[model samples]
Target: MDTEKYVPGISVDSNGHPSEIGIEITPEAFKNLETDNSKTVPPDGETIVVPLQLKATELTPFDHIGLNWNPHGHEPAGVFDVPHFDIHFYMISAEEQLAIPAWSPETDAAFNNYPPIGYMPADYFTPPGPATAEPQMGKHWLPGNLGAYLPFSKIMIYGSYNGKFIFVEPMITLDYLLSDVDFSANYSQPEHFEKAGNYPTKYNIYHDAVSGNTYVTLSDFVARN
Candidate 1:
């Protein structure tokens, strides 16, 4: 697939600070996705990782974005086992992200190293069990009682490693993206930020009729320390 069709962009405020960052997906690009699960190695699943460079200096703290496509979803089964996308707005560099070791006895401490109390959002917590941390990604924190009972569709996630927040994520199902309705929702915010910068307080998913494109956007930036 021509990954270039998936464009990553940023919108800035009057003060020259980044107000929004998003990815634009053309209608044709969505239809031509890979769906074979067996082809991918274990742990990673049938996933495609697309790295995004927004070329905006105002987007400090956040180095780039990682657009991950899970064709058959992932683990902690029955909850996120369907097709979906994990969009990671990473504050760390791609090199640092890739340097994360695979989950194992030797790397248990690293994967399980979570952020401090006030750094995490009030409502978000790690899924119960033997560390749901992913290699090269870090631990995922979800909001509310999301389990086998609640049907998976779309949700916001926060990621951290070694007591520092690294990424802001929006996990959306393939079904939801294919639908016609536009979506906008407020995501939870941490009591305090680990790094001083502009952070998105809200996220949105909308379809452009004229351009025939889909946009998953993060906006409503607020400066924090």
Candidate 2:
């Protein structure tokens, strides 16, 4: 879309590893994120990522932010710091088939057996601050809503080789792909997350095709109860 390439699986080097978010989602990079099945691609290539997470100190330093799937600015990247609640992502591209309703609790509508992603419900409540009274990190899995995790959420992906969602090379890392959506690993304690205990969120996931990729950095992001 933006002329491709936005790698960031920790921007490794000097021995840390990862130089390009673990590249290798071939099949021409999942047929270049698709538009019309790119000729029924699948000599290998198919992915569906967006499995929420965050809590590596909530992230800071920025090449990109707000979605923790990293890589949004084309680079050997790494940055974070920004996320106090106000995340965004809705690229449901099966060439676009998301009317999501029939009892829209946030989906489980099953046109594709969903949940390759997480924490949605308008990202835990819409426009205002502290979205519906702060304290989030998980919830909403079946007509959802139980104080739905809090906010400080997560969801991004990097899968192909037939996994399911190839929305174009989206392997996450580097503070979950460029942190900082106003950030907060407790930014002045927004009630220090009221309910769902054990709060410590982190997320870095990537699983590619042509055979190359791996990273699931989420030590934890609790507060679920």
Candidate 3:
């Protein structure tokens, strides 16, 4: 019997419509985890413990945002230390983010060891450049899905690397359609961000409802004028 196929699940739409999708889990994958874990798992199915010493030396982006915005104002930026933050990314499909393959020792050995790609220091964010200029950064994690009208709406599990979990939550609302120029200007000025008196401390993830593709950015909050 094929263990991967499960009953279809329903995802509700904004207008109260329900759509069916197969949210599946292979029985053996979890049952035999120790023998067939992916590259992400360390030897004992335990994550490698990054040292507390490193936390004293470097403050992650989430650390900075929380320190600056935390309700109690208890922690100073770059002062208190943490191991990880719960960061979620919106993805177009489960395969796009993590493609599970046929279990094999060979494939397990090839798990990617690339340091989390697309990280930029707080100092690199500048006045937005021309509309045609290359974006300031690359793929990254965020505090949440961070956009509206996300067609896929599937949230990827949180991830951490090198003792850092970046986070940026735009205060912008998604009530209106976004134009190319308007989108660019939002990145340039980011009124909501300015009003909040915080820098774009993390990044954003957006899904193209039409094309069904997912994208990441440090700017472009789909908010009001």
Candidate 4:
């Protein structure tokens, strides 16, 4: 997968703090996506890790970005079984993310150790059971009152590990990415932060007709104590 085709970048304020972070997906990159699930990681997915530019790494808490392509989304059956991409802006290093253990009886304690009450977004909740925690990734927190019967398209997700916020994710379906419409929305914020840094309050997805590229950006950063 031509890693260079997917560029991760950041915009900073006058003081050098990150104001926006995003990924630029070239037209060829999206058009040539691997749709065969057999070629992906076990279950049905392919993950491409892109290191943030040096400037971005120095200014923001995130170290890298992970683009996971799901040909046939895993688990929860009807809810997320469609083809989509899970964009993860990871605060942890690539090595640390890889060391995360898969869910099992032995690793139950590690995965179940939920973050303190104000650490996660106000309305997000970790689904019950050990299956909620994924290997090489972490546990996913979904909106408390999501309409289960509705079709899955796009949504912002929060990821945590061992009681700490590790990554911010935006899940977008393949069909949506192919559409002409653009999307921008404010995501819910947590009452407290474990790490002090500028955090994004909104996300955007748009297609540039001239460049024939798709941009997924996180903006409106607000400093937190």
Whole-model lDDT per candidate: 0.77, 0.25, 0.24, 0.83
lDDT of 1 by residue, 1-225 (tens): 346767788887787877778878888767766677654332334223456555453565667667777878887688888888888888888888878766777777766777878898988888532466887788888886566225988888889876688988888888899895798888889999867888889999999999989898898888897
Of the candidates numbered 3 and 4, which has the greater lDDT value? 4
- Runs of candidate 1 exceeding 4 Å displacement: 39-57, 127-130, 147-149
Q: In each prediction, how many residue pairs overlap at the backbone (N, C-alpha, C within less than 3 A)?
A: 0, 44, 0, 0
Residues 90-127, candidate 3: write the lDDT tens digits. Answer: 11122222332322444332222212333323222312
Question: Candidate 3, TM-score vs. the true structure?
Answer: 0.18
Better model by TM-score: candidate 1 vs candidate 3: 1
- Report the number of backbone clashes for model 1: 0
Q: Which residue pairs in model 3 clash with each other?
A: none
Runs in model 3 deviating more than 4 A are 1-81, 99-138, 141-225
Summarize candidate 2's per-residue lDDT along 117-203 as a digit string, tens digits.
332222222222121111111111111242333221332222111112212112232333223222222111122222233322333
Among all candidates shown, the one with the greatest TM-score: 4
RMSD of each: 2.7, 15.0, 19.3, 1.9
Predict model 2's lDDT versus the native.
0.25
Q: Order candidates by lDDT, high to low.
A: 4, 1, 2, 3
